[model samples]
Target chain A: MLASIVNPLILGISIGSILLISALGLAVIYGAAGVINMAHGEFIMLGAYSTYTLQSTMGMPFLLCIPCAFFIVGIIGFVIERNLICYLYNRPLDTLLATWGVSLVLMQSSRLIFGSDVKYIAMPEFLSTNLELGILNFSTFRLFLIAVALILLFITWFIFYRTRLGIKIRAVTQNKEMAASFGINAAQVYSITFAFGAGLAGAAGAMFGALSIVLPTMGMHYVVEAFLMVVTGGGSILGTVFASTLAGEIQSIFAFIFNDTMARGLLFILIVVLLRFRPQGLLSTGSGRR
Target chain B: MSFTRRKFLNTAALSSLALAAPNLWLPGAQAATSLKADSPIKVGLLFSLTGSLAVPEEDSTLVMQYAIDEINAAGGVKGMPIEPVIVDAKSDFKVYSAKTKEMILRDKVISIFGCYTSASRKAILPTVMQQDNLLFYPTCYEGAECTQNCIGTGPLANQHSFDLIPFMVDNFGPKVFFVGSNYVWPKESNKNAKVWLERSGGELLGEEYIPLGSSEFGPVIEKIRAAKPDFIFSTVVGASDIAFHRQFKQAGLKVDKMPIASLTTGEIETAAMGAEYGAGHFLSAPYFQTIETPTNEKFVDGFLSSPYGKNGYTHYNMEETYLSAYVFKNALEKAIDMHGVTDVTPRKIRDAAAGVKVEADVSPEGLVWIDGDNFNTWLKPKIGQCQADGSFKVIKEAADHVAPDPFSIYPDSGKCTADGLLGLDGKLKVDLI
Candidate 1:
């Protein structure tokens, strides 16, 4: 009985961390910039490809590739913001379409360059093993992911709450015109915020690429869940975290009772039901900012 | 004027005469060397160059070209140079159907070689049959299908599972778990394995199917940990195979203790998943890159030297695709001899494919022959254990070519002969399940 209970919970937490990591980037972008960011998954895919290039071609250590992926994708995100996204700021629908087009370009470009074969990202020797703690037996890499997710969350929290840029970002997210009047340079804040969020996605991709296979279309798999956590969480970081954990546990419990397919189907149904009841989502922002 | 009974009989008589003694009856046999020095026999190379199926299908496409080039270098098939009319199906089933029509009706290629998934093959089946064209499919599939329009050169369901299941049961315990991608191929392959498992008195602990391209194996892994099955019979294909192996490794399931014996994990997948993750896991295929035969060695060396050899590993899919071109070549030669060089059509080539046989020298897999009765090729099954060097080490192999039994699960199995489904009508019949 204890094994049964602990196993699902541990599995739930493990999957929850994966969900949270993947959702963090989308949440950050939607929360701050109010951009739906259709290319967020591609940004994550680019991060994985960046990590793959670094590790495979450059022979960089896997631990170093995560931050490198962040900066690499972050730089790319900065360029995209300056060139395209900056043009369609108040035009949310246009930004959505343009970012989606950007995603298609990125996907095709990666296919051409990498040749669409699945590539592997090697992890350190220690992380490949498992951790057995009585009834709580799990992958060490999963535990590492949990730790990484927490560290990332804490850092993002620190950045958003404890920094001067955080104030500028929050101010801009609340009122772009007012922040521009206050000399905050709301456009610059949006660029930085978008880059940061993309960097977070890149970081997630580094871990994810190591976690699974790397392919040109691997982003499509994670993007759905990322969007789910973002939308259901009302586009806030804390809300995403809570929603992922809750969703993971619920999925785990359902999977434990039934099977993975049924669990996934039931989870989608439940999410639909949840959304129908609460149109503003599980946790709505108190701020009256669109 | 129409496809009259007298016209059909005459065509059939001519084809049978050609099959019996092509060298004796062909008046063009003497003039063949002078007939087609400039004119080339066009064959369609239909494969997905983009989308989800592109990765594996890329090698298949390359190997098809390599085989065609090799055939052309060897004095061409019946003194006519073969030209490939390549087209990307874009990994869509509808595109496969459209391309089949376009290749048959528009380009008028004699024969086509392509398709990795059974769905794509099924999509093109009606078009091929309706247009009386031939499609040479090269992917090992869950075989409950037999058709004259398509010649399957890959291993059938029985060819893969018959030997592997018994081997697993004898080596490991009797408790087996079935995991596959939720699709027709996996489900059918698993169903085939279940039949074999029952024959060996093995118990199935659990059977589960995950959606295609899924990465989260945690819930499934948890269930596996709880069940403690002796071995896992995985049919998970594509990129998902990489995650399944990595997470299985991370979940502390030692291959020595409880191995993942799979049908889908090949050289490309194993290399991409890493040797560390796949080491000690088992796979069953008709061909592996590590096979120590002169034919396979040459094939591997030639593929690695090719422009499309960047991935640097060859598996059964490529080997089969390569051999399939040779199969088509041999069949087309007979067809050309039967209907003369200029008069050869897809219908004539499809007729000749039934009697075509390729020897060991040209084929990487030894001595593959298209069954004149069923239009499926005979294949040798091999069980390989994944090594730490990202290659599979052949553990066991069939001493002889295993004849394909596509409908082995049925009591009236193998009844669908060359005359087509149930040996009654020559119409296309696919997917028993």
Candidate 2:
């Protein structure tokens, strides 16, 4: 029995790792700019597509393709911020609506180009093969994803607390108007921060693309769940990570005991209960409610 | 609107260039009005590529394109050429309605080949029936959507599910429990299983349904364990299946200890469940790449050779849609050949379909047969268990072959095809098989 739970736990951990990676970027965007950029998923799509185009089409190796996919999508995110999300900073929900329209356009464009069918990214031998140990098995590519995600998570923390760019970004997030009065480049930081968040989503998508098919609207289920994950994880990097792990573990156990439907139902109920108790999150350091 | 032949030629040349610019626009499209006038054949390749249903839908459309390639290469119906029109339904019923209307009203397509979901099929039938156009629905369906206007390329659950019961009972002597998503497909599938069990004198320990897309299946697993049923009959779909298979694997139940006979479990869903998550699960479907047939052998080869399926997929619909295109081609040719007419219409194709019979190389069984509703019969299902290496083993035939019935298993119960279902109790008055 103990042996059996090992696999689901690991699967949960993989799901949690990506959720945390993707959600933290959104958390940072919110923490800095109160705007929820709904097109964040499209950036992820862009990243996956970029990876697929490079690795599958241009025949780039998986190891080299990751950074390329991320940066390309991040640059696109930056362009999107400059052209679209920059001026809408003051109106949060309006930003949401605008991003939603942008998301539709992006989705439509991808469909027009790729022809509305799901596309498999086709991982190479190194990323696709698996390692097994007494039923607690892991895919080689998935392990690579975890390693990358963890490294990024640590680097993000280090930047936030120990680096100059991190300090400036934080200052803008803490009090954007005050930071502006102090002559910080708040708008540039805003653009950079939004692009950075999108970069994270793109990275996650590129990693996930190896695991699943890349459909244009594939992000719908994960996007909402990720927003919830960010909130439950306390809306900070550490908070989001903590919440995602917590949610992941709970979901695994419930799914282990109940089934997929009941597990999701129970998890939803558990989240509601947690909200009633903490209102902000279990590890929350912020004022907002997710 | 008067035009000289020179002007018409210039206008046509420009339009052809525009259509030719995007090669992917119509994969198997033929542009030739070089023949006689007053007769046309329009073919619709309908699929969901942009929206929610694009995942499985991509394979359907791509494989259909391959079939159209084979048909057009063989010289289209009466050699007048095949015009392949694209319809991206995008997973919306309203969009499906509007596009289908456009296909019938505007394009005047003689036949349509697309749609995966039961709801999408149901939504399009009224429009297709009203316009009296033929539709070839190429997806394994919930089994109740068979109508005069539609010829299903997909298996109804009964043919696969009922056949498996007898085979599993013979091989494993296992007591059975039913588990599936709480939806129409599973509900109808369970109904079919119940009838078969009743006929076979088999024991039915329990039946249950979980909400679709739910990730927690622990309590149900516990109940199955407690009941100590020897096996499970699962009708779960897509992601829910991955979650279920993972949980069951975690519970220390080996495939041999408690075998699973499943309806909706296929290569597409199994592979997506990932090799580790869904390893060693059994499925019953019309065609398996591993099914011993020269045709199937070539099909698997052709699909893998293509860049789209370079990574390898257990796409059930891809095989079905490929065969369906062949089915469409044969039916159209038979109709035209018999009548000696160049002007092909939907009515002729539908009439020709009734008399047309074609054999499939891809079918698990040797031949493909079509009943009154044009649902093909030759491709009976076989059991295939997923292997650790992410492939499947053909567990041999449940019978020499299983038959498909589009309406009620008891066909007479649906002289009243009221709402695509009979009343409660599900007691069909006829045996369609």
Candidate 3:
């Protein structure tokens, strides 16, 4: 019984870490930019496809493809923001609609290019093996994902708290007009932030694609969980991390007790109830209201 | 204009008439003789061309077109060519239902051929029944359903799992774990599996279901490890199947140690998931591309030479789709001969479809014949193990055709019902040759 409980707990931690990594970019963009970017999932999909293309066509190593995917999707996101999202930022509803439309366009374009077939990325042999410790057996790729999630969290924290660029971005996010008056280029900060968030999504996509088969519609599968984590976490990076961990643990425990379907149903109901009590989320950064 | 009773009635009548205009324009009662002999006989191709299921459904569409081309090349079906009105369902059930109605009422297609998922088939069933149209469903699915308006041209679960479960038990160990996506096909197939496994004296270790399109299998794999089942019986379909196989391989579970026997995995999946991930996996189907027969050789060669075949590899679903189109053509010819050209309706075609047989020489799969009562086909069962090259090496095959038992009544009750028809207890009366 104890072994059973311990195994699920470890599994929960791994799943929570995955959720945190995937939702990190969405949290960053929503928290900092105050724009509900509906195309976030598609950006992640683009990252996976980029990794697939690079690894399959160019013979790039799996590890190298992750970062390459980041830059490719990040640049695409940067251009999209510069041209489209930048214009609709003031109107959040319009931004939501525009981003949703952009997501559809991206999904269809991917279908057209990839021919709606499943593609796979080969992981390194070491990552494919399992790490067995007594009663607990975990996948090495999942362990790698957890480690990457931690590193990402640290990097995000360092950027927001330690760097000058982070400070400027934060200032802009707090009050764009005031930051502009103080000589910070708020538009540039927004663009860079959007690009960084997209890069994070790309990184998530690379990991996820390696975890599963990459397809044109792969984004839709992960986007729901990403949105749930972001919304539950209140759009703040720290909040998202906390919420993902909590939700993951709760879901895993519930699944262990009942079943996966029931656990997910219960989890959704619990989230609704939690949202009813805390409409602003678990932790809201008092900015981006306007 | 605001509150007059006569004006209100007029407006309501006009709106109702506008809403009913589309249905009123339906040419349902039109005679087949009205179609010119030179003009093509319109048939609806309602397979999903886009969305999650497009990978498999695209093959069905391609094979259907190939069959039409084959028939057209042979001086047409009695000199009347078949023109397919293709519509993409986009992997949505509502879209399938809508398209079925549109094809029947507006396009006035005589028969439809398509639907990969059972949900999509079930969604369009009501529309097909209400419109009195015929549908040739070409994918193997969970059975126990027999409808007059549709004919399933693929093996049912009994034809697949009954022979497979005992084979696995005899060769492999008895302890089995079943996993599948949380859906009708998987759930129903697993239910049939449990019965067959128990009958074969195999012990079921555990059963689990993950939501469709779930990427994470870490917890499930851990659970399977704890259970230590001899082999996994997987009914997991679509994207989840790829994820499970990849993760299972990544976890260093050797296929030789504990192989997965599946009803769904075939050439298309093996090709997509790569040979390494699927090597040594087992699959049960009526057809495989690697099956060496002169007919299959010609079919594969013809397909490979064609433009549609260049898109991707052919699988069991594609073969079934190809077979279904031929079956429909045979039935249509018989119907046109029995009933005059003017009287060729869905009912006539369905009536003539009874006992319609495609001989071994023409069909890629040895011999296939439609059972009129159950609307399922008699197909020879073959169990194969996947090799490194994304093709199956047939390990076991039935000596003769296994009759379709969608309800699995033969195994449940030990009575032989000579003909290939259902007995009193909703079971197939097994005929001993």
Candidate 4:
């Protein structure tokens, strides 16, 4: 009987690991720029595709290819921002539409080049095994995912809190004009910030690809969930982590208790109520929006 | 050695008798007894190759190719070679509908084969029904649907649930718990399952449902443990199903004591779950990738050699899609022979299919026949259990080659049950005392 609770909880944590990695990047972008990066998930797709191409075409081992995937997606993100995003600063809604367009283009390109077939990454040796602690069963890869996410999150948190660049970025986010007057070079900062967010998403994509089947439209499917995370977690980084873990647990528990449709419907209702009561997410600022 | 003998006999027969496949020849060329065989027959392969269903869709597409190659290598199907026109539905229901229409109307395919999920099937149905085109649906699904123009090559509910209930009742002694993803499909499946479970002298400990793609299975598993049913009848679907199964195993539940007999969990899904998590699953599908036979061996060999096949994507729906090509071919040949039709008209091809009895080597069952109602009899469900080596072992048979009773009574349709599970007929097979 105790096994029952521990099993679902472990599974929830595994799923949460994936969600947190994927959502953290989107959350960072939105938190920093207040620009809802709709194409955030696309960066992950690009990363996955990069890994796919490297593995299938170049015959590179996946271990050697992970960083390559990250860098390639980072470059793509940087390129996209430098070319398209720089023109639309201060226009959040337009940025949303523009990023949405970018997402469509990326998805279409994947279909065109890859023929829309499902592609998979050879799961690493460590990923395909399980670990047990007493009665609690856990997947090694999922635990590894949590470890990677925590490291990246810490690095990002440290960069945002301790660095001179971090202060400048916050200044730009809070007041771009003032930051510009202070000679902070907010434009370059925004560009790097966007690329940095994209890289994290790329890393998430690389990890997710190894764990699950990769397809062209997987990005859009994840984008919705990421949006949910950003909305539910709001602008608070700590809150995002809390909500991410909470949402994962709630979804898992509800799924365990009821039929999937009812569980999801109930969760949607719960989120709505959460929004009404808190006006943001459960851990978000009041009237918090994605 | 037996296979070698069979091949030898085939070669000897080919040389001794200048047998012409009359069905494969063109009208004017039939007088010559033998015909030319250079031009390949191009058939379109459509599946949700992207998005949500892409995993299974890719599996099916690869399997389809494997089957086509296997058939063609054996001197082609009825002396006509095959060419695959592949398209991806991208897991969009609209794409399935529109692209299928385009394949039939504009591309003028000989026959169309693809699609695994219900959403894709439903989206593709109206277009096929309206156009009266031929489609071979290759997935185990709810039984309420029937299309005269389509042959459901996968097991329907009656073929699966009715037989399963009896088998479980005899083996486990009539105690069950029905768990499913709550939707039209599972609800309908549960209703049918209850009727059978009660009739088979079994007790339903509990029935529960969850949303589609749900990840948790704790609360339900706890309740199940409390009820202590002999086995679980599950119909969970998608990625979340993976999470549930993983969690179920993680929870330290006694799987050996209570096996999960599921509708949605099949060879395709097991491969997706990967070997580490896929063990201990017992499932039933119309066909499985691991059935040992010449046809299946050839199918497996071809898949293992292919790009996607190397990764162990031998899924149920994928193999079904692969077998469906042969089904379409057999039907078309019969139609053309019977009607001298060359245009690939839907009515003509469908009529031809009704006349043909196709035998694909890789079928879980040895043979399949299409009934006059456009329902296939050969697509019988085969029981499988996941083994350590990333494959399902065919442990048993569901029926003596079950034929779909398309005209069975539906509660919504006011149709009564067909041949009863209580005795032979479905009528008078109520759950009441």
**Top candidate, metric lDDT:** 1
Clashing pairs in 3: B409-B427
TM-score of chain B of each: 0.88, 0.82, 0.89, 0.80
Model 3 CA deviation exceeding 4 Å by range? A1-3, A288-290, B1-38, B409-433
lDDT of 1 by residue, A1-290 (tens): 79889889988988899999999999999999999899988999999999999998999999899999999999999999999999998899999999999989999999989878888899998888998887778789989999999999998999999999999999998888999999998889999999999999999999999998888888888889999998888788999998899899988999999999999999899889989998677888866877
Q: How many Å off is the CA of B12 in candidate 3?
A: 19
Q: Which ten residues in a row have the lowest lDDT in candidate 4 chain A?
A: A281-290
CAPRI band for model 2: incorrect
Clashes of each: 0, 19, 1, 23
Ranking by TM-score: 3, 1, 4, 2
Q: Write the per-residue lDDT of candidate 2 for residues B1-433, one digit (tens) a residue.
A: 8999999999999998897565324222231111133354568888886666776777787777666665666776567566678878877989988898777665767788888777787887777776667788877775655355677666776676767787777776658889988877788878888877777667898776777554445456655765677778888775566567755655455678677777766776666555665566678877676776787777777767765564366456777777677677788777667665545556566656763555655343356666644344545676788787667788766555455665556565453231233435675332121
lDDT tens digits by residue: candidate 3, A148-170:
89988898899999999999988
Candidates in order have lDDT scores of 0.86, 0.69, 0.85, 0.70
TM-score of 3: 0.93
**For candidate 4 chain B, which ten residues in a row score worst on lDDT?**
B28-37
Each model's Cα RMSD? 8.4, 8.3, 4.5, 12.3
Worst 10 residues of 3 chain B by lDDT: B412-421
Cα error of candidate 2 at position B207, Å:
7.3
Fnat (0 to 1) per candidate: 0.86, 0.13, 0.64, 0.17
Q: Individual DockQ of the candidates?
A: 0.65, 0.17, 0.62, 0.23
Compose the digit string of candidate 3's lDDT tens values, residues B176-268: 999999989888888888898989999998888999989777667767777888899999988889889988987767788789999988997
Interface RMSD of 1: 0.9
